[model samples]
Target: MGRTKPPRLDGESEDDYYMRLIQKLANEKLALFARYQMEQQQEEEERKEVATNLLSLKKSKKSSLKRKQRDFDEDDVIDIKIKNKKKKKVGVTTTNKAEQRPVVVNKVTEGVKEFIKNKMKGSDLKLLIQKTLYASDLNPGQNRLNMPANQLETNANDFLTADEMRKLTDKDKKSGLEVDKDKKSGVEVGILGPNLRMYDRMLELKIWDMPCTKNYVLISNWYNFVKEHYNFLKKGTLIQVWAFRLNEQLCLALVCPDHEDDNVAFEENLHDGENDDVAVAASASEV
Candidate 1:
């Protein structure tokens, strides 16, 4: 106890402990600041790398565009060369060969007109359509004649009466035919064969309205007409159809030059058989 030094004061010891705590906090703050700086530096490097990649992509795109332009120019040059070669190959001989081919004139036969005037006592003979029969036309399953709207003559509608036109163009009628008290489905029309004889049975005239186009079809007893003329009504047979009126009724005359002579001996009376009867009502979809 004689040699003991004076005891340290409590205030001084507390002050020393506080100073040590402050120094520890300052060390922790410095470490946190250094970590933040390192993170910011890494982010800057990442940004620089992204900018470089974008620049490289732009350069590649420009090169690809130039390559495409060069390829397109080469293709144009090739096309021009081919055209010049074709022009050189074409000569007067080719034109003369084309000119030497016989020109085919499309005209209605006189017999058809005589049939309309003398036999049927029908007038206003007008060419309706001239077409080569297709497989569909000759097919027994499709027993109807299709008159394409585009192929119809400019005055095709001139043959139709006002009532007939209404029946064909009217959207209200489902079958494009006038329904009367007798339950008639379509216009009662007669089809005259190349032999100048009226069809044994009546036929129906209706319009088939499609999404892209419209067609006037002959149905109802068409199968019988086709069956009777099956020998000459085959596919690829060119035929002319003329429209005329008989007793104010619509009549169509079919003319086939190939079978004109063959059918001459098979002529029947124009007013014979069931020509006055109502046509058998058939669905247009059957064709």
Candidate 2:
């Protein structure tokens, strides 16, 4: 045998075996080349897999970063909006405070003085009122004959004090009336003590029309007349009064019994329209 030849590929076609001798001459080199090509292909596949994993990780990181950034931006916007709203509220409160102003209350006594000055222009009534209000007659023995009405009315405690009188005079300057500021009613009513004696104070008679509530002049010097007709100033009798500012003292312009009609006969009556149940029961038994 010529050096033993390597076995041929079985069932080799003419094309397959055409360069058999040449192939056999470089077989060792060819085998080495084939192994090198296979290793190169395997390395390429491993590199592609590694690159894909790295790319996926990078993409995930980028997406996470973008999401975090977006949330941060939204939070920043919300914070800015809240701050703006607070600023607006503060501005409104400040503006409101600036707009508000204090109200000025007028002195009540000033208006009454002006009214007295205007109404009693011709008469020396203003001087008399001043004297009547301010005259201090603590010493009963001295000048007892010319003492003020206030001194004569033994129940001075039942009357308004000096400070109270000041407040009352300062309450409503336009109307010399100590009106019920809370009630806002045009009509003002007050009860006087039984021992009240009006010696020099001006007085007028006023008749009340229950249906119309209109005051009609009936007579003057009503208090003086009450002394003569003692029955007219009876207990629980309703009287209409018009208060005035006499000097610095509170005075009444008119005071008279309230009447539904002109048949002005006075008698002691039950207090505050209260019915006498005993009298009614007695009448029933008589019936």
lDDT string for model 2 (1-287, tens) is 58565566889776667578667658646544533443343334334434544455556675535543434333354355345534653112111122122221122222223333453211122211111111111111111111122212222224344554343234455876643322122211121112222233233222221111111221234334444434434433433322333333434321232333332221122121332432332232222
Q: What number of clashing residue pairs does each candidate have, in the order they appear?
A: 0, 1
User: Mind giving the per-residue lDDT tens digits that candidate 1 earns over 122-163?
Assistant: 787887777667656655555568775656664556888888
Off by over 4 Å in 1: 1-108, 173-185, 260-263, 266-287
TM-score of each: 0.51, 0.17
| lDDT over C-alpha atoms for residue 193 of model 2 | 17
RMSD value for candidate 2: 52.6
Residue pairs with colliding backbones in model 2 are 108-170
Scored by CA lDDT, what does every candidate get?
0.57, 0.31
